[model samples]
Target chain A: MKQKNDKSRAGRRTFLRTAGKAAVAAAALVGARSVGAQDKPGTRAAAGPVEGYNWNEHRWAYGIDTYRCIGCLRCVEACKAENGVSLDAHHFRTWVERYVYLEGEETARVDSQADSQNIAASGSEKEYRFDNRYKDKKVEKAFFVPKMCNHCSRPSCVQVCPTGATYKTKDGAVLIDHEHCIGCQYCVQACPYGARFFNDEERVTDKCTWCYHRITKGLMPACVEVCPTGTRIFGDLNDKESEISKFVRDNRVQVLKPEQGNAPTCFYIGLDKDVS
Target chain B: MEQLFHVAPYTGYVYPNETVFPWTVMIVVYPYLTGLVAGAFTVSSFYHVFGMEQFRPVSRLALLTALSFMIFVPYPLLMHLGHPERAFNAMITPHITSAFVAFGYFALFYVCLLVLEIWFVFRVDVVAHAQNATGLARQFYRALSLWSDDTSERARAIDRKFMFVLAVVGIPAAHGLHGYVGFVFASLKSREWWGSDMMPAVFLFSAIISGVALLIVLYITIAKIRRVPIDEACVRGLVYALWGFMMFTLLLEGVEFATLVYKGKEGIDIILEYVAHDLFYRFFVFQFGVGAILPIILITYMVFRKVRGKTFITVAFICGLLVLLQVFLMRWNVVISGQEIAKTMKGLLYYHVPVLGREGLIVSLSALFGPLVLLWIFTRVLPPWLDRPATAGPQ
Candidate 1:
């Protein structure tokens, strides 16, 4: 009975291996046929979806509705918590900017109070004073702009790194391979958006990862999850039904520093001309 | 740590991460030191390749100066790095598009060229010392001579030819050495102050000025210390060269500033405001006023007036010292002041020189003096004096 059982188990293992091979071969053939079909004359390739792994299938995008941001600082706190970022004000993966446009002023006075602990206290309702100089101006209009990594199509940091430690993923996120980074800070200087920083403890360049870990696991980024107003939108551009795609299509959006030609994926609604 | 970040007195909307200047005084020292090496090597080439006979007296000393400074050029950069041990990764796995990737290769190539040139220039003397000395000293000299004790006229001829060829090759290598440093700063498109096509030329000319000035000061001081008669002709030539180079550097700077002010670009207002409010003293008073103008006027007077005797030497010496200060301040302004203006174009960032920290003034001074000490030791090993007999014992 023992000999018969051993023979039966071996036979089952062989059958399973053969089935797996056949499935993989059939999948490869299908993939090849689809690719060949894409190349056929007079046929347009699909706009968004690329045939490959799940990562390659997705193209992530972020949208900010500047009108809706309340400058609550919750998203900033959530990002710091999720990433284990240092508590120092100088180190941040994301921050909020408050723009005050006084009546009859051509240039709006802009200040980003990313350091303040009491971000909940100051907003459109109550006039706040900062640096002893920014006393409640003759108020006209006010709004908040939250800034993070634009995650450019052609990232300057990746181009400037002496080692290929900083790279762009297939899912359109710029990431740093921390283990390989030499910490020369060239990337820090190269980034026009001021997105990159040298984490003293980690001994490597740090930047916004688009919350890569959670997104890859089919979860929303911590910042987006914690946002109260749905001001921060994160979704796959490849999926037409995703909120980010709909928002981007419905609203006229703009990226910061378009003159830089970085081709940033992060789009903002109601973007002010004063924003850098 | 918060105190360090808070210390930067800012005026408007600076990116939070930009409040603390990333590159510090150590970075400033790196370029200053390299400029010295490039300048000194160029001065040596004046004699070796250009056949400027007046520079002959100080040719070997200038080469030695270049080598001494070149050896320590990488230390400041290494210390500034977050991971000093992995610095070689830049060389082993260089990303081609990065301007900084050329650093390791340029440094290695320039050093090797200097070594070969120095060896060929000092071969005859080393051979003579090897023949007369005894014990380990003899063995060391013999090894330095590659165990070849041939001091024949034919051998001397070959050595001179090789030295000439190496010196010729070293001219562009020296230019590349400092020009590449300038390129490192200039290639950063993000920083408006540093991003200019004129940077490489400006750095190269300033390097020549600093080199000529330093050699003048060293030659005069060494002569005074040794009680040897000052080489008046050589001093005059160097002073004149210093004047010419300084004028050229100033012209380049003038063009760059004039264009920026005239063009009226988007960020021009903020940058100009930064220069006016924050850098008024350092940029205008020290670098342009006392450091540059004073030396240029004094050196010019000495040059055209055919000034001689104690007066000429004293004025020339003062001008040399001033030119060194000028170049140093220029590096400070270029490296530090460039960082002072935030990339946001909304405000200015201030940097306070730390007293005793890693990127502080003390560390910078140590990096500067370390090369001088090395040069002192190197001179003890192989005397740079052309007048000394080849068989004379080491000092």
Candidate 2:
């Protein structure tokens, strides 16, 4: 019986290794090289689906409803309070972008900037001024796109870290372990969306954790809680009954740069065309 | 006169409105490669300048590693640049005010130094058999001499003068080449992580660590392949050099951290928060924990016990590989993490590594393997180390 068990274990190991190698080879042959590097299912299976450690089982994702967004700037304020984000103009955990388009009888104009803090001051009158014309009833065509970390499912930052400093938690929320980071900055370059940021104090990398500390305890993320218009929605994406899941399932949702093949978990329902 | 003076208009459209290759990426590959070059050159200096006799076997190997890697320094930057063709502008009409201006001169000085040293060392053999070489080898060796008379007396005189001069100048060039790469990132004002003054020193020291380790591995592999007796004494001395560099590097980083944490700048706090809890595992575990500390411990044990065996050297080689990997991670963290903080001060941008893709592990492995292949090709024709001592008898 002992000999049989040992033979079975050896056979299993060989079978798994062969299967893994074959999968990698097939991925390469298909020209989707990125698919090969993802952690094999067996590797994930080894963790035994422990709570918080089983990332897929406890997915934490966010949805933003562009229609409901009031651009009140409350979420930005809340993010600062929670993350101890710097008050300076150069650093922000969350910010708003305003795109103003001017189309006239003879000419047209468009302007956009990523850092816009005083968005609330622009009332409906000012909002309509650009798109409104007395005769033609056209003024400024403008809208706001609040930008933050997408918390992608296949984060480029996590792939390039040689030390495994950046990882996805069991709940499918990507997080970084700062203690192991050596301040090398490989993840920064790997990111297609410019998400990762380096911390100056500890000489290491830092970025959004999807509020892992709060979300794991069943608290809404700071951004979601402070959003006065309920524009930002956060919940377990895996649960079909969760508001985020329902919105995504009901609406025509879009992920940024699907061509890049990151399969970003963050979804924007009613996303603007100029957002990316 | 009009035709002669009519250069292309400077619309500056050659560069894009926004760069696809980010600053963080440039910072990663540039300083990392430069560090490796400087480190390798320093290992060569141990034998040539300081006459650390035990390190003599790797002397040539060090020079070749330095030379080959130096060739690749321009590749990453060129690939990253919006108008790669305009790279020559740095040499032609260099902006004196720009810090990068020094890089052009640095490359020229070191290239000249390496050329002179290699020529002086190999001129006699080339002259004797210049006719025997075929194709590129013949052309290369013929061009290498630059039509100079390769007589016996002149060769001896040239070698003597060059060996001494190169030993002196190469040391400073090695320091400048790598240190200045660090200075590029260190000089940038926008990035908080690179703003520290200690970066250049840290980069230079780390360069030495990687360079020495690389040379040791190259030397051992070459010896085994050539069927030559492995020089135990040389291997031992190289380990000492590795240990020495690692010691200085560890101390320097510690002091840098202490100063950074103590000052407690606004940026410093945010940086520390991410580095401490987020990057802690990588910094403390792989880089310091396994890459640096473990090797140092093993080396110390060998040093203390006077243990001399192939196993000790192999362990050192493995440690050296780890050190290089550690430094690569160090560059990654510095470049990526620095940008992870939200520049607008609201929310951090999360970076996820792309699953297997062109820009993923394959490219990184290719960068390393590319150099190794170049080194192999370099050895076949150039023969980085002296197999049979030229002065042993009469060739």
Candidate 3:
């Protein structure tokens, strides 16, 4: 009787092992099939429709060369006209800023937007024309950064938004779905960049879109297109052959508040220290 | 001009301008949190000061509201702060000169005072209530009262004496606690929008308005939800209070506006342009029309015309929502408008509208939703009105 029982136990163990092997084989087949389905039509490894599009793929960035900007306000004008931005006190898609830093032995000045009116009014092509005391030089520096949304990879505005009204596109661009937005302005507070503005006319908040409409259609942003000196370089940084990619790779790049952990996609090649 | 920016090669470690977000958020959240504090205390004052046994139904709820709101008070400021991690530094090495430093101290003292006062108020009942409470709540109230079984005459007398002292101290602490936020804005020399002695007074008065409004709304809503009969007389009295405070707030705002437009101070003219043309929708449409004027008219009509029950409560609720909007817009105009003017005041550029991708509407709406959810969930665990045993059932 003991021998007979041992034989039966061994049979049961072998049967159980066989069943487990069969389940593992089935799972592997399903996994391989799913991977194959995801792969590109031509390549075996082109797994199914690019399983999750990388956010960096859709990002369109613009880097302005402070040296090339001549304080011409054409970019501001172009942005306003192109975006139908109202001149009301509450609606600004983009704007220019002038910064003045006082240092010994050197006086420097720049404007993010090289506007003809600002340049003509200041009457000098260099830093001295903007500052009266720096005429011959005693160390005064002034510049404009032409600030806008940095379109960070891990945007705080997107993270903290409760309604998911603000979202990042696959190409690393941050855009607001106005239809979904409830005009709470919580994102305005979450953002360290202060890039947000509440549009009283629309009863919704607005900010720079990186000219998403223009860019998706294979055109430059309004600001970049209007710029005369080609100071603003707009391109997909992910494209290694793109001008923006080359500039960023060749020159040291800096982003605003790197410690903030937003990992901004927009990289400035020759950004001013005071303006960052 | 054509001059290039030559500094030490930029390593991107520059100090970015503190986003107007933190200030805007703080202004709204501070006032809202303070409103809850004042509202909770006002409810408690009826029992403590007036010796109203009828208010026992709401006593615990009020104390709970005060504590919860106090916890959330610093959240808005933290979200706004450039260095949120360094927020605790203000407490350890306080800048005595800054109004915020004083606000931090006041918040601490106010919480302690509220806790002690609550202990005294609920000392006897806590033990009785503990028999019914299970698990965590039973343990909580037991531990909270420090297991003191003092039923003696001297213990009661001591508790009363301590409570009286705390209540007396609380009045100034509460006033300073919320009023100091007003002082923070009023003290800003750079901001013409907030540069007014009247701001602190306005803030305090408006706080009273919001406080009463919130209590009335909470009381009515809770009564309705629980299918309990509300104290009609209290609701009527609260409506009158709302009318009186709303009128005061309106008059003050009118006077401030007149002074600004008439005096034509350096920054006032520019502010007028923004208010009249630029910010007309938010200022007139939302803040004044819907927020201040509409509610004022409705509540005034209801109070004087002897409107009763749900109609009056509905009007009062609308008034509360409107007043909240008024406070929110007031903060917006003050914060955003102050920054709209260029540092040089020569470059008058409009504000940039934030897209959803950046931190704009999403984060703010979430913060707002936080309090609402808390208030709702709180009602489930703790009744809004105090549950009183019948005369025959208990003493």
Top candidate by DockQ = 1
Q: In angstroms, how far off is B62's CA in candidate 1?
A: 0.6
List model 2 lDDT by residue over A20-46, tens digit each. 644443343334222323422212322
Query: What is the full ranking by DockQ, best candidate first?
Result: 1, 3, 2
Best by TM-score: 1
The C-alpha stretches of model 2 lying farther than 4 A from their native spots are A1-276, B1-21, B24-26, B131-140, B147-154, B344-346, B352-363, B389-395
Extract clashing residue pairs from model 1: none
Find the 10 residues in a row with the least total lDDT in model 1 chain B: B386-395
Task: State the lDDT of candidate 3 residue by residue for A55-151, as single tens digits.
Answer: 4455466676555555555565555555555433223455555555556534234333233334465564221122233456544555456566789
Between 1 and 3, whose DockQ is larger? 1
Q: Mark the regions of model 1 whose C-alpha exceeds 4 Å error after superposition.
A: A1-54, A114-136, B1-7, B390-395
Candidate 1 CAPRI grade: acceptable
Expressed as tens digits, the lDDT of each residue in B1-395 for candidate 3 is 31111111111121112222223434465666776576567656666666666665565566666766776777766654433555565566543443455666778889889878867766665655555578999887577558766646787778777767776676667667777767766665444566677877777767667766666767777778778787776666666766788888778877866776787755454566667776789877987788789988887687679787777767777787777678667666656655554332222334443324222355567655566567677554443445445211111
So what's the TM-score on candidate 3?
0.56
